[model samples]
Target: MEFKKFKLFEQMKPTIRKEFIFLLFAALITGGCRKIFDLPKEKDYLSNNINFSNKIFEPILGRTNLMGGFNADNSTMPMKFEIVNARFGDGRPVTDLFQKAPTYVWTTAYNGLEKSLEEIEAKRKLEEHALFEIRSSGEFIMWASANNSLIKPRPADSTNFPQDTRYFDLKITNSGGQTVIKDLQVRPWRERPYEPSNDMNLYTGGPAPDPDFPNNPNTRDYIRPFMSNVIGDATDVNLGTNDDENDVIVYIRPFTGGNGHSLRFKVLNKDSVAINPAAFNETKWDKLVHGFNMQKTTEYVQYDVAYPIPLVEVPTAYAPGGSRAHAELKYSRIGFGGGRVVATFGIDFAIYKKGDWEIVFHFKKDNPKFQND
Candidate 1:
């Protein structure tokens, strides 16, 4: 009986080994197939939903706004974006998606309107179109001006649509060839009756002739006026009865610099203008005189030449009431050699009242004399 049992056990062992081997082979086949066909492919490695971080953006008509950036689930994969279709609220579609438009961007801190063309050129760069391409990191930005939107919205209608709305359709494609469509909606910031015109409430002390500018009685011929933060109207501005408390006056002058070649500031309205101090009435004149925060700096240039000197820095005063509520600016410089040269310089002045005001004095000398002193 023992010998018979041993024989059966030996035979059963081989059969058990065969069954174990078959099970192991099945598992290997299953795993190999999964590694080849069941594994995820490039197409599966995409965002389930791709969109813009800002679905709706509000931008002022003449101002620039950064519209939106991409929001993707798969940031690791390279992506590209293009404006596939753009339409305004009225259903007008953009004819050309690749057309570039000229748009201005603010690169430097706004120093009021005292900015020079050279300074603006140096600081700001233009974007040719409303929509920009995606950045290297799969992000996109929209630099647009309201008047020049991708899809120019219909003119605002108070009765119909007070606030204008615009629509943008973008196409995004990943490196894996998977594509996605995203949308952006833009609206004008606010809707109110637009002012037909604003004069910047400019009030002058009356035009006076600079001895050097005999051809032109007003320096305005040589200087361009840039006003900032001016509100209300010139008719509404009042210095009150107290000249001491309400006197707000500014004077701008141009003088000869060290080389007798460059034009600079002498009195800068901090004092009375000796050339024609009595030109303005006492009521409009400031009793006190103050200097600029930064004085004009430049090298002398010859006469009849256009040279730009940086404007002085002035602080902004919103809604009136400040240390400089009532101040005066006067400018004067002398050159002596029978008016051998002419030069131009820009000066900046700040004042506060119902609002802050910045005035840029653009001055040019038709002729200047060389002075030894």
Candidate 2:
């Protein structure tokens, strides 16, 4: 019996050794997996709430607009962002978005103190950029090369369908792994060029859609508001969409001739006659802007200045808000109530295109009352 038991133990020894070796190999794999990754795991580290501030990306044609305000709560830095599966609403591929085009890329840091357009242009170099691309940290840019032919927006007519509302997916990758954000909208419209672009909407080169008109004593000024009251005055000061009604319309006209780097301001009364700049007694024409060599005429007031007003969007002696160039025109006189009434017309504007531009403030209904009632 002892001899038989010894033989059985010898046979079990081989199986036991083999099992031990298999368990040891499995433990080595488990230990090696623990030391594999340096960064956080995609599920563990990446925030589930990472999203955009605005869902609808409405990029105006002929210009680059930043699609910013990405909320990445507790997400790792240097996370790669990519635009993927871009297509139109009709399920067609947006191949043009992937193609590269010439773009103004900043070579050096812009301090906003650059004097001329040439100086401004010098700091930037024309580089090939994708029409629609996302930066690694997730700031999406719609390049100026995106035109109406490529990305069509909702037309001015209500009956027309939105031809091409581009849709795309965003892929964000970290060291651990990648996660994809699905189905982002890109609805682009035509450019209105300058702001105070209230006159047009769904700007499809059609008869301006639902024009926004403002009343006299223009509310553009928030500090010292305009005061006006005419009891017996018969001026058409109605701010309406009526074709006949004439509100003080400010027209920005660019000229290719005679000192391209200049801005001239003109005011016309109801009868198509130019108003004397002296009539606006309260306006400090010289201090109104940061222009040099101010030339005032009975017909117009000219300023030899930089092409784009407020060269950089910073609060200065010229631009108070660090955005648009603000101009307030004030003229005071006695009213029917024996009180000092002031008629003020203020405009805040910016010119992007480089040329001699003229701003005409036409009081269409009638001439402003400068005489006591």
Candidate 3:
């Protein structure tokens, strides 16, 4: 029996050796295949320290809002950003946000140095885009078309019901790797197309408030002016009694009746009567703004030109920097002893929404003392 077992083992030895050799050759080919199809490993990676300056967004409807606050800790520049899993609090998809619609986007870089509306128009082009998206620069954009009705509603008292806001995730990627920022919040409010909002809330779209723009005027008043500077000394006499800010209030009102886009400036007195534009003798109506076809009348000074006062925010011939539309009204009045006091009432203002707006300067104290003492 032992001899027969030995004979069986001897017979199986050649078959077992052949099987081992075949397996060894298969392993060699498998190892060579890896070398034959070598692939390079990714070198770049997403930084764990990535963060955003502003995580929450509350953009008003009726205008394009570019909400950008990305802080790439150690990540590579020009990183790609994509919005994914945009939905309501209940996990329902926000389909309209992803759908492309008509939008006015700036193609040319706005250095704030453009002189005319023609130059501004050359930069801006009306194109189709998603209601909400992340741009290549990691800036989040909420298009004008993302009206209040399409988004998740924010109740009048949403402090108690915070879940009414929209939620979205961001997928930031590079050639190396990608990371998703989850559960970003957005609460789109109703559209208040213009500023000094009558009903809608006035919000600082950025993280910090501009020190220059201390406060937004009440809806009733566009700007309440004070004595910025007195050219000459007339302290002994009450020089027009411009003591209070409400002494002179400017009202910015948009109107439809005009040849085309226009802006009209007028002055009013305490009695709500129109002050003659001729009273401001020193004010060069032609150079006061970038508007053309100046029409000076007893009631108001109308200009038939661009919709926005300062085509660009920069300090060109019209506005100062910071995208604000600035205008200074200058007039001289004789003080006691025939001394002239050139008082200047200056206002730094901005109008983002396009319209034929009228600025009415109401003198609450008294009609600007244009009479010689």
Ranking by lDDT: 2, 3, 1
Stretches of candidate 3 exceeding 4 Å from the true structure:
1-39, 107-120, 144-153, 156-160, 196-222, 229-245, 305-315
Estimate, for each residue in 144-252, the C-alpha lDDT of model 3 and write its tens digit: 7676566543565435244466778888888868888888888877655444443233342222222345374522323455454333223233323232334566666
Off by over 4 Å in 1: 1-44, 89-91, 96-98, 103-127, 130-154, 158-164, 176-179, 188-373
C-alpha lDDT of residue 37 in model 2: 52
lDDT, candidate 2, equals 0.67
> How big is the positional error of residue 312 in model 1, measured in Å on the Cα after superposition?
19
- For model 3, what is the error of residue 255's alpha carbon versus the real structure, in angstroms, after optimal superposition? 1.9
* TM of each candidate vs. truth: 0.36, 0.68, 0.72
Give residue 90's error in model 3 in angstroms.
Answer: 3.4
Candidate 3 vs. true structure, TM-score = 0.72
Q: Which stretch of 10 consecutive residues in model 3 shows the poorest summed lDDT?
A: 202-211
